[model samples]
Target: MFVIGIDGGGTKTIAILVSSTGEIVAQATGGTSNPNSIGIDEAKNELLKLVHSLSIQNPKAYKNVVSVFAGLSGIESPKYKEEMKQILQNQLPEIAVTIDNDAVIALFSGTFGEPGVVQISGTGSVTYGLDSKGNRHRVGGWGYLIGDEGSGYAIGRAGLHAAFLEKDNRGPSTEISTLLLEYFQVKQIDSMIPLIYGERARTTIASLSKIVMLAADHRDQVALEIIKYQSQQLGEQITALIQISTFQLEGKIPVVLTGGVMNRSDLLLNDIVKTLKDHGINQVEVTVPKLPPVAGAVIAAFQAVNKNLDKISFQNRFLEDYV
Candidate 1:
């Protein structure tokens, strides 16, 4: 039999067809299927297009498909999950369909579907944990306005705040002011106001995180402090999850760190690790996923049907073929 797995998020969607033996038969990518970003109809259309593309790539494999698992962002509520599942099932009448949050696939990507925690820190941030009993919990991911403390937007906004403080002589001088002026191609810091409040305000602010990372790498005190504080916030989320969940404090717990900001900045990763250690959580085995979250969706498909994939062999083949 064959299975279909999908990972859909705010930016893009990936779908893959896999054989029972763990061979990836066909794959396709398309625009975002996130219903929250795009309307539900558009999201459904995007997903159907990608799945149709996969079928066209390998009709024989698609014909044998038995199950489909879709891990999507912005479908946290049970109402949304049921709505998407019904839509997919209506289109593919004979197949079994499952829908869940994108965070589930992210955790599976790192833990091979075992119990673990996944912390995502991109333009926004969120922390999710699954205990051994199959109980799941989440913290943060409230978006830019209220939460997302350790996210790229937060770091960038902090950098911008520090620059303004320096300009007003209310804070110590830092390299971020010069960096922001140059980054925005403005002759003076105030000239960036209009550009920052433009249509892509959130992304624009998030992009400034790279400048903050650069400044921290150069040992700028303000940048380092910003990173330090953000790392602490992230660490607190992890620790809080552990304390609140069924996870044993002394047991070997896997922690998967993914997302653009977490992946790119070793300095920030190190700081987070230090924060965890300082909090006396030594049993956490932190790692970056070798495969993307879509792989986890595939794994979930296999699990849904009481099937299994050889973890090491699947990883080797997938990295060779897809990465």
Candidate 2:
């Protein structure tokens, strides 16, 4: 049997085909399919195109696929999820389709569907935890406009704010000022206004978080402070999840960290771990994901079929090689 897994985010969509034996046979990519960002119809179309492309090269594999697990952004509402599921089911009537928010699969990817916490800090930040009772709670992820306190967008915005402050001689001089100026290629600090306010503003700003991390690596005080503060915010959110979760509070609980921002920067990761420890969340066990989010979707597919992943040694080894 074959199963398909999809990880759909604001920026892009990825689909992977896995054999029942756990070998990845094919993968495909498409443009952003976040229902919130692109409309439900567009997102559905993107996914359909992706799946069709994957199947075009290997029709037999596609036909044999029994289940599809998709993790998507902008699926917070059950209405949206059901709508997406219906759209996908219509496209692949022979297959069982499961749809959930990106975080759900991310958590599953990290913990293999076990109860655990996953902290995502990419363009935006959000922390999700699953309790033993199947209850899930999410903290943050309000977007760049409101929350997303400890996200790449937040770090980038903080760096930009500090740069602006320095330009106006209102804040301490830091490497970020020059870094931002260089990154944006603006003759004057104010010149960044038009580009920032232009197209893909959120992504453009969030991309700058890398520069902030670079500055922090160089021991820039302002950059370090920004990372520290953001990490603290994320840690606090994790704490909130722990308090309300049904998971054992006293023993070790798996905490998984994912997303580009957190994955790219050890300084930020260290700061977050430190903050967690300082907050008395010392018993937590930070787990390195054994598989990517797409693989998590595959695991979900297995569960949908009432199959146990632990019984498959090849699947475990396949996931280990990739991670």
Candidate 3:
């Protein structure tokens, strides 16, 4: 029988149709379905609707599907997962549905449920680890107010603050200053505060992260510095995950770079890799997850698939949707 996987995050919800043999037959994309952001009711409705739509598209094949695996961003607590599973089971009574936090699947996706580190950077940020012995630990992911450092919001806020600092002659001139002004089409830093705080101007501020990345790519010193800081922070997260891990490893554990910040910015990713090596953790084997996290969800759904974890490495060669 075939299987399905769903990855629900703050930015987007992704679903993948996987053959029992693990090849991707089809995929569908939808808007944000984070239960924390969009309430549980809305999130559930959106997820079920998307799944139903995809299932119907190829009913002859999908009707044979037997299980579904879902990894969501906000369902961290057991109570949350239980409530979500009940809602999902009610909607998909015939199919076995399992729910887990998004980070679990991300770790599973890379190490194939083995021991290693998976660092995720999306609307927010967190680092997760699972050792060979089934132990798990996590760091960061406290949210925007206290944590979520090196995230898009953090990057954008840094750029904006730097711009205004230069505008008032409080800090040295930075490329972020010029870039932010140009991005917002504002003349002065003084005008930016009110503009950003305005209702209409609220959503566009996060877009500044792209501009910040571009500034660093062009060798802007301040932007590069910001990226370096983020890289170090990310590296530190991995270090903490490894240090706190209870898994007994024969050697250095592998590390996987997942999420937007690691995948998007070479400055940060490379810096992280270098930091690992510098710390003498030479066993780092960084592999890009073959499937978007939705695919990871599908894999998680097969928790009872009775297969060895290490045998399926999620390498580029793996997407074989078996009929």
Candidate 4:
């Protein structure tokens, strides 16, 4: 028998076919299946495309498929989950289907389906945790506008604000101003105004986070301050989730740090760990996932069928065949 696992997000969707023995047999990718980013119909179409591709890539494994677990972004509401479940059920009538937020798979990626917390800080940010009793909790992930305090968008926006402040002589001088000008390939600070307000505003602004990271690498005081503040905010979210969950009582809690921003910058990651310790969370066992989030979905597929594959063996097989 075999199972399928899917990780769907605003940017893209990835699906994999894994044998009961934990060998990855086939994989496929498709465009965004996030119902919030694209409409439900379009998202459904994208998911179907990915499944069809997987079947075509390896028909034998696809035929043996018994269950599917999809961890999708923007599937917060029950309405969206049901809609997604129906879509998968309609396509693979005989297979069991499970739908959940993308963060679930991210957490599972590091914990291997064990109870733990995962903090994601990419274009957007969110913190999710699961307790031993199966109770789940989430913090942040409100998107770029109102929340996402420690996200790439947040860092980028702050960098831009600092650049403008220095330009207007309202704040301390920093190299971010010159870097921002070069990044947009413009002569004056105001030249990038139209671009910033353009259609891809969120992504465009979020992209500036790399520039901030670069400045910090050169030991820019202003840029370092921004990272410190953002790391503190993210740390607060993690601590908040821990306090609200059963993890607070546990002697040691697993905390997985994933996503582009957290993974790319050792500086930021170190600061977050420091902030957690400062907040008295001394028992956190922080880990960076060796397996991708999609692997969590695959593990979920196995658990759905009550097949308990050995963790070390599964990781070895998955890494050899899929990673």
Give the count of colliding residue pairs in each prediction: 0, 0, 3, 0
Residues 73-170, candidate 2, lDDT per residue (tens digit)? 98877887888899889988977899988888888877776778899888998989877667778777788999898889999999999999998999
- TM-score of each model, paired residue for residue: 0.93, 0.91, 0.87, 0.93
- Which tens-of-lDDT digit does each residue in 150-249 have in candidate 4? 8999999999999989888899988888899998999988888997997899999998999998999899999999999999999999989988835433
Candidate 4, superposed: residue stretches over 4 Å from native: 20-22, 245-249, 320-323
* lDDT (Cα, tens digit) per residue for candidate 3, span 42-95: 887778777877777777667777788888888766776787788768866877
lDDT at residue 28 of model 4 (Cα atoms): 91
Q: How much does candidate 4 score in TM-score? A: 0.93
lDDT of 1 by residue, 1-323 (tens): 88898999878999999875568889999988888888788888888888899989999988888899999998876776788898878867877899989999988989887888899888999999888777888889999999998999999999999999998889989999999998888988788899899779998999899999899889999999999899889888887787774654347889998877876658777877888898888888998898889988988888888887789888888777783
Runs of candidate 2 with Cα error greater than 4 angstroms are 245-251, 310-323
Distance from true position, residue 238, model 1, in Å? Answer: 0.6
For the record, the alpha-carbon RMSD of candidate 2 to the native fold, in angstroms, is: 2.6
Whole-model Cα lDDT of every candidate shown, in order: 0.87, 0.83, 0.72, 0.88
Please report the candidate that would top lDDT against the real structure. 4
- What value does the lDDT take at residue 216 in candidate 2? 89
Ten-residue stretch with the least lDDT total in model 2? 314-323
How many steric overlaps does candidate 1 have? 0
